[model samples]
Target: MKWNPQDIETFLQSKEYVDTAVLPLLPVAFDSEMGQAAGMSEFITLVTGQLERQFKGRLLLLPGFSYLKTCEEEKLFTDLLLWESQLKESGFSHIFYLTSDLFWKSAESRLDGSLIWIPSIPLETMQEAQKISVVESQVKQMLTLFTGKWHEKE
Candidate 1:
């Protein structure tokens, strides 16, 4: 479920079933004059929206974390760890980050959560059929990873 008032109400009542939090880590490069950058950001949001819908009852989709693409990512580590702590305190045992950015995967060990890096798919330029095909394919892979983690905790 996405972070909103109605979802939070439901979440509070059934917190046990909603043990996982999915955070979309997006990097916005304001300095980039590349035309595709904006499209990439939109694609990330749509793909993550699909994933959230697929895993609705079990996952809480938090508002995405956006940072300057050119900044030092190491500087965000402490902040991310603190966010993890707060999520744990709120009863989410599993915190997973989904991103098209590859940087987080390399720093996963240092961060306090599991990071899944999805290589970028240019959805903005694709035909509807093509976009659906890509989103569906990626969602399957994401589902597999999510399920694997869920079962592991059993």
Candidate 2:
């Protein structure tokens, strides 16, 4: 089954968030015109490298949520939902991303099976380094615990 993405602040991860990383969303307007927006895509790729260096397998980013001059969060969210569906088929159990806007104020798709809008932390409230630490500490804790348990299983 597939789920649609919700733009409200209600469809977020259950844990509280701290906002450590800056997710780059290149403008969608000039993507086929000026070629500047593509830079944002490249930047996202570079950031993905950093993410791999850090979180590796535990990363969740909306695929095409960057609209250069468009105010359509619903469309962006729709793409994100599609991405999540595909990712889940590939074995992803958890997803996380840093959203920069106050989603509750925005109107989005009301489609059935859409991702519910919920954020663990309001984007406006997260401090930069604090977000990073929260993610890092949690990932470290999960990894260490899993590693220990796996060794015992062996």
Off by over 4 Å in 1: 33-37
Per-residue lDDT tens digits for candidate 2, residues 53-154, read 454223333343465444566676676567556645644444333222334225333321222222233223457676565445544544554345334534
Q: What is the TM-score of each candidate against the true structure?
A: 0.90, 0.35
Candidate 1 lDDT over 25-108, as tens digits, reads 877776653444555566677778898889888989999887767777667777788888999999888899888777777788
| Clashes per model (N, Cα, C within 3 A) | 0, 19
**Deviation from native of the Cα of residue 113 in model 2, angstroms:** 14
TM-score of 2: 0.35
| Lowest summed lDDT window (length 10), candidate 1 | 32-41
Poorest lDDT segment (10 consecutive residues) of candidate 2: 14-23
